[model samples]
Target: MSNIIGIGGSIHDFASCLLIDKQMNAIEDERITRVRHAINSSNPCQPSLQYCLNWAGLQLEDIDTIIANDDLLQVIDPHVYPDIVLVNHHLTHAYSTFFTSPFEEAAILVLDGAGSKLSGTNGDIRETTTYAYGNKNDVTVINRVFGDLKGKNYVTKSETLMSNSIGEFYRAIAENLELGWLVGPGKVMGLSSYGASFGDDRFISEMMSCIKLLPEGQFKININGEKGLIDKFFQIRQNYHKKEDPFRIDAAIAHAGQVVLEKVLFHTLDYLSTKIQTKNLCLAGGVALNSLVNGKIPFLTKFKNVHVFFAPGDSGTAIGASIWGYLNNSNQTDDLIRFHSGPFLGRPYSSDEIVTALNSIGLTYTQPVDLYHQVAHLLSRGRTVAWYQGSSEFGPRALGNRSILADPRNSLMRDHINSNIKHREWFRPLAPAVLDSTTAVYFDAHCLSHWMQFVWHVRKKFHKILPSITHVDGGARVQSVSKDENPSFYTLLENFQQITGIPILLNTSFNIKGEPIVETPYEAIHAFLESQIDVLVLGEFLVVKKFDLTFKSPI
Candidate 1:
């Protein structure tokens, strides 16, 4: 009867997971504290740990173990932890996804900024892209790739050779392009689609010179670390910047970086596939969040099967570390995927609780004749609704339960949400939740992506119909929802389709710009009050705050 609690904090996306016997409860610190990435905060994971303990009906003493992914555990109070295991940072990322993957024995790919040091010291940094072979309870490393997560949170020339550190290259390019840190990659992914697909006369030469794949299947770079690559990138970008359209330069830069990243990853995966000879591949870490690169792996390599979890970054390491501890310590025979369950891993309130919350918020509410139909009707009329139902989601992306849903067909809906509610960057692409049956007809995703993890091409015909969700390059990261997985969300989509003749809904997370998705009924109501959305659905309750709505989108 070992109750394991896993904590991952510091820098960004802090989280805690409680694995009690057979059930697993996990939550991100951003959701509870209403912060963006849960960065620069004191006492980072205490509130999240407290919530996990309360939900599991256990206390500190009842817990058998707590695991952190770093030797220097970035904890609020290390004294509270009597005996916490400092698992290797990369191992946590690796086992977290591979152990929970559907594959019995798969090729594991763990690529983040810089993995933990092998010696856990000042200068000892582990490999960045680590390939492993795993079966049942044992996951063994088979190959290592070029890169480092040691210096300056990324591989710097001071620490390692300026080889194929893909994460650092992307981050640096984005920062020089004025996107700042890792925030611009998603936007650039969308932007790259709009650029010429790396023409012969394009900036591909410079990018290749900076990041080259050798004949021996190694990625090398001649550019000096840090400022050297940035200088060349800015110089090459200046050619496009001279164009009348300001976006031309930025789009070209994004396209160049994406081209280099794709080439390096393809080479790496191909090399791993040959060595491991496995049909299944498991991907984890911050770099795993790149859906564009992920979609191409199967096409370029021998691995036909690929598995990725929603929270593959630092935040997900919490659950991964806990699950790893479970497999290692208990009699469990790798049943993580079976017991993994859905991502709605937070609090689920009852109808009575919803009523009480609505009353407390001083809002006029009613349990409509059909909650799905009512919300569907609002979406049909191009009204945005904050949908907070069932339990909160565990990852950064909001699936269906906690979402701000709108009509994807509305050309203005994207701008409407941006200016009115989210206040997000113009380049922040929107996502859609389509009926699983209709996924292929609308998107050429090549596989099912219910987690909004892969970018699927919106068919030519459906492009105009789903403008709000469609990226400039005609691809969108989509969630294909089926009735069995989520009945209410599926039904809402069905009803909206019956009315608007479209089965898709623009599903952005349910929150404002600088905050995480709403986690509770009260938080949903609070977001509704702060934004200009028309409605808020908390379970069976449909609430409308008595406030004047005068703000309008400039679009």
Candidate 2:
């Protein structure tokens, strides 16, 4: 059996993937290091690499080939390791989504803040956006856009008419707004819905004029130099913070940036539809994490079948590179590289490990006869639960395996969790974990979002009943649970349906802000105790707080 390992090494989001024959396992360094993005030295993700090896009972010497980015050779000697193959950043991103998808052929679109740096006529630039098409095992790039750095200003390369970059535009706005660098884009996306409430069109118009759709599925950002229009809005927000509408300017800027991004994506997808005959579309890179834009692609564009992998960001490049290596080494063309299983590709904790962790923490627990029934009843009665089961998910989302589940019927549940448990922005929305069979009953479209990659509008009739899960705009980042893939989560959903007449529950990542998702049983227990979670489910065992820690909302 051939063992291929893919390494995604950078200053941030370092990860490793192991493809043994057809089976695949992947994990980000952030999950093991307990850092948001695992900012580290230029090397392979050691902790993640160890985890993958331990999961499969293998060692470094056993790996037949190591596929990684060219940037990894900066710190270490290349001759010390096994046969190493270097691949480009955007090509790996393209392969991560397209190869994992069920589509035989699909148009691939990869858009990120920045990719591998290359020397240009003016200066060094990084790849920003790439369009490619994948047929069988071959992925061919059709067009590309580069983000050129001029002093402190980021812009498209000299070839494009617009000075700015489509990939970097939203990040620029987010940074100017002081939303932070690591997790700003998501906050900006969440803050967008409130922009229209202030009745301000100036920011929107100004932002729109900066971005324009170009030919050949390309778009450009043409903002002013250095401290441009985004900085102007930031200055405006400083004065607005003292007033009642503290987030008025911030919201407007976010909304404007979001509008431009969606427009560009829609235009690009339409162009791709005209170029490619297949109805399938695969999206990757950090920008693909925007569920709002991803949701609109299926309905707004000509592509009817859209596939966005679980780990579509930098973390997923490891899987992609590994797949490329695996396919190249194997002589069999009929053998397809795919995640035939699901996204729970991390190392799973055994029952003994869970028990040992509980013992070490001195936490009392009980294994109920019907664990799903008891947990579902607790949720029905308005108790927040930290559910830890099986292996951790391979993406930013916590899909059932490592999630905090709550009752969606409670209108105040969202605010309570935001302020108390998550310690995040109040405007940020929570997601819904619904039974796959009952998705059509509540949501407008019967889209099967198993990976929480799409946002669907909640049906008007169930809006009031499921207030906590639905966003302010009546849309929800939904994860439809299936019995075949996740039996425990599906059983819990079934039990929840029997208790509350709704097969839905509020779900979010099982971690507070500034930390990555909990990986080990120890981290899970620690997170449960640190927060106000009423029940902690570690496999079949249930643990609750010894004292009366009733949730009193600060809001």
Question: Best candidate, TM-score-wise?
Answer: 2
* lDDT of each residue in 211-285, candidate 2, tens digit only: 667788766665445445554455556766776466776787788878878887787777877878888999998
lDDT of each: 0.76, 0.81
After superposition, candidate 2 runs with Cα above 4 Å error: 41-44, 71-80, 119-123, 151-164, 197-199, 223-230, 239-244, 332-337, 546-555
Q: What is the TM-score of each candidate against the true structure?
A: 0.90, 0.93
In candidate 1, what are the lDDT values of residues 1-555, reduced to their tens digit? Answer: 789988874367788989886578889887778776787767667778899999877889899888888823544567877688878777788878876677778888887666665464454444567778877667887766555432231333232322346666676667667776646666667667766433423666777776657654466544444435765565556655686466766777778778877887888787887778789998888778888888777776888788888788888888877887787688745353434466778878888888888889789888788878877877776678888888888877789999999888888888878877888667667899999999998998777887887887799998877789988877888899988878889999999889878898999988886777888777888889889888888888887645434543221
Give the lDDT of residue 212 in candidate 2: 68
In candidate 2, how many Å is residue 172 off? 1.6
lDDT of 2: 0.81
* Model 1 stretches with alpha carbons more than 4 Å out: 71-77, 146-164, 196-201, 214-217, 221-227, 235-244, 332-338, 545-555
RMSD of 1: 3.7
